[model samples]
Target: MILIADSGSSKTDWRGIDKDGNVSQFRGVGFNPYYQTPEEMATELNDEFLLKLKEEVVAIYYYGAGCSTPENKKGVATALGNLFGNAKIKIEHDLLAAARATCGHEEGIACILGTGSNSCDYNGDKITDSRPSPGFILGDEGGGTSIGKKFLQDFIHDEMPAVLKEEAADRFQLTAQVIQDNVYRKPFPGRYMASFCRFITEHTSNPYCYLLYYNAFQDFFKKHVTRYSNYDQKKVSFVGSVAFYNSDILRKAAADMQIHVHLILESPIAGLTLYHKDNL
Candidate 1:
C-alpha cells in the first residue's frame, strides 16, 4: 500500500492506495511545521488518522507546509516514521504537491491557495524551482487568509457601504468581542483568517473583489513567478477553494495579464493522490 498526504495550515488530506490499487481518502486536522513540530504533528495524526493504518503499509509521501528546510523535513520524517514504524516515508515541501498537480505532464506555474499561499515553477513531473513562500507575513497574497484580512479590514474600518455592512454583520454573526477573542485568544490564527473567506466570496462579483483579485494575482506573479522569464508565456494554475471555486474572476484577471490559465482545482489533493498512485 502507498500513502500520500497533502497537508496545509488548516486541514490535511490523506489518501491511501491499497495493494489492489483501490484508492481511499481521509481527513485530518491542520498540521503546520511553522507552529507544530513533527512530534506534535504526529500526535495529532495519530489521534485522527491512526485508525487508517494497516500492517501492509509500504511507502508514504508527505507534502506539507513548513517542511521546506532540510532540518524540518528530516525531523518530520523521523516523527512520522516513529508513528508508521517500518514504513518507508518521504517528506517534502507542499510546493511539490502543487507542481505535480498543476504540471502533471507539462511545465508551468502552480499556486496553492488555502490557509496560506505558495507558488512554484513545475517542469512537468517535479518542481524545478519555486518562489519564496513567505508564509502569511509579506506574502500569501491570494490565499483565504488574505481575503479574510481584507474583509475584516472593510468591516472593522467602515469601508463597506452602510447597507452591505449591516448585511455582512448580520450574515456572519460577527461582534467586536468575537473578533477580539478569535484574533487574539485563538489557537490557530489561520482559521480566524479563513473565517473571512465566505464573507469575501459573498461579495466576490463586486468591484471591490474585482480589484482584489486583479491586484493579488499581479503581486503573486510579479513577486514570485516572474523571475523565471523562460516560463512567462506558459499557463498558471490555481489549487484550493478560494481560487478554484471563485475561478471566474481569477481566470479573467490572469487573462488580463496575458497569462493563460490551464486549470483551477478546488482541492489539488485529488491530483496529488492520483500522481502518487500512478507514479509511486
Candidate 2:
C-alpha cells in the first residue's frame, strides 16, 4: 500500500493505493512549507483520518510547493513521518509531481497550471532541466492566479473601456473590500484569485477576455518555458485542473512554437498514486 499527495498553496490532493489500483481518496488542508511551519503542517493531519485508512500504507510519496529546497523537504518529510508512523516517506517538489505524472518513464515537458503555473523538462529518471519559474509576482504566467490578478487590476482601474464592468460586477460581486482583503491577507489571495479564474471559464470565448491568455502564455514561453525547444522529447503534456479544463489556449501556444502536445490530464496525483504503488 502507498499514499501519494500532490499539495499546492490552495489544496492538498491525497490518494491511497494498493497493489491492484487506487482505493481511496481524502481531502485535507493545503500544505505548502513556505506558507506554514512544519508543526503547523503536521497539525492539518488528524488522528481520526490517520486511523480510518483501509490499509496500512507501506510508503508515502509527497510532492508539493515550497519543498524544492533540501531543508524544506527534510522538515516536511520529518513532520509527515511523525504523523504516519510505519510508512517510509519521500518528498519532492510539486514540479516533480507534474513531471512524474505527465512524463513518467518517458521524456518531455511537464507543466502545472493551477493557482500557479510552472514548466520543466523531464528525462525519464529525473527532471533533467528547468528554468526559474517566478511565482505570481515576477512570473507564474498562464496560471489562474496570474490571470485573476490581471483581471482585477484592469477592472479596478476602469480599463475595460465599456459596459463589461457592469456584467463583471454583477457576476463576481467584486466589492472594494473583496479587493482589499484578497491582497492584504495571506492565504485569502489564492482563493480570491481562483474566483477570477472561474469568471474567465464562464466566458471562455469573449474577445475582451482572450487577451489575457496571449499575454500570460507568451511570457511563459518567452521567459521560462523556452528551454524545451532543445529537448529530446518533442511531446509536451500538462497536469492540473486549470490546464485540463482549458487546454485549447495551451494547445494554441504550443502550435505557435511548433511543439506537439500529447496529453492534458486533470490531476497528477492519480498517476502518482499508481506510480508509487508499483515502484515503492
Candidate 3:
C-alpha cells in the first residue's frame, strides 16, 4: 500500500492506494512543522485512521505546508517515520505538491490560494523559483484570508456597500470587538478570516463583492505572478479553495494580466493521487 497526503493550513487530505489500485481517502487536521513538534504529529496521527494502515503503508509521500526548509522537512519526515515504520517516507513543500498535481510533469507556474497563498515557478519535476511566502499576515495577497481581511476592514469602517454591510452584520452578528478577538486572540486566525469568503461568494452579483475578489486577485497577479520571468508565457494553474470558488474572478483577473490559466482545483489531493499512482 502507498499513502499520499496533501496538507494545507486548514486541513490534511489523505489518499491510500492499495496493491490492487484501489483508493481510499481520509481527512484530518492540518499539520505544519512550524507549529507542532514531530512527537505531536506522531501522536496525532496515531489517533487518526492512518495508524491502522501504518504497517501496510509501504511508501508515504507527504506534501505539506511549512515543510519548506530542510529542518521543517525533517520534522515532518520524523513524524511520519515514527508511525509508518516500514514505509519509505518523502517529505516536500506544498508548492511542489501543487506543481506535481496541476502541471503533471509539464513545466508551468503553480499557485496555492487557500487560507494562505503561495506560488512557484516549476520546471515540471522541481520548483525552479518562488517568492517568499510571509504567511497570512504580511502576505497571502490573493488568498481567502487576505480577501476576508479586506472585507472585514471595510465592514468595520462602514466602507462596504450598505446593504451588504447590514446583511453581513446580521448574518455573522459581527462586532468590531468580536472580529478583533478572532483575528488577534485566537488560533488559526487566518482560517477564521477566510470563513467570511462564503458570504462574499454568496453575493457575487453585488458589484462590491465582485470587485473585492477581482481586486484581490489582481493584487495577487501584480505582486506574485507578474514577478516570474516570462510569466505571461507560462500556463498557470491553481490549487486551493480561494482559487476554486472564485475561479471566474480569478480568470478575469488573469485575463487582464494576459496570463493563461490551465487548471483550478479545490484541493490538490486528486491530482496528487494520480501523480503518485504512476510511481506506486
Q: What is the C-alpha lDDT of each candidate?
A: 0.77, 0.76, 0.91
TM-score of 3: 0.94
- lDDT at 258, model 2: 68
Query: Whose lDDT is greatest here?
Result: 3
The TM-scores of all predictions, comma-separated, are: 0.91, 0.90, 0.94
Lowest-sum lDDT 10-residue window in model 2: 46-55
User: What does candidate 2's lDDT look like per residue over 1-280, in tens digits?
Assistant: 7778888877788887776774788777677676577888877776465556624877888899778889889879877876787888889899899888878898888888888888888888798777776667766778777888888888888886356678888876876666877787656475567567776776667866766776676666676566666643467788776777677887887778766778898878877876776764
For 192-278, candidate 1 gives per-residue lDDT tens digits of 877677766777667775676567766766676667666558778878877876788777776776777888887778888777777
Predicted model with the maximum TM-score: 3
Q: Residue 57 in model 3: shift from native, Å?
A: 1.4
The residue-by-residue lDDT of candidate 3 on 22-119, one tens digit each, is 99999998887777899988887875589779879999889999889999999999888888889999888999999988998889999999888999
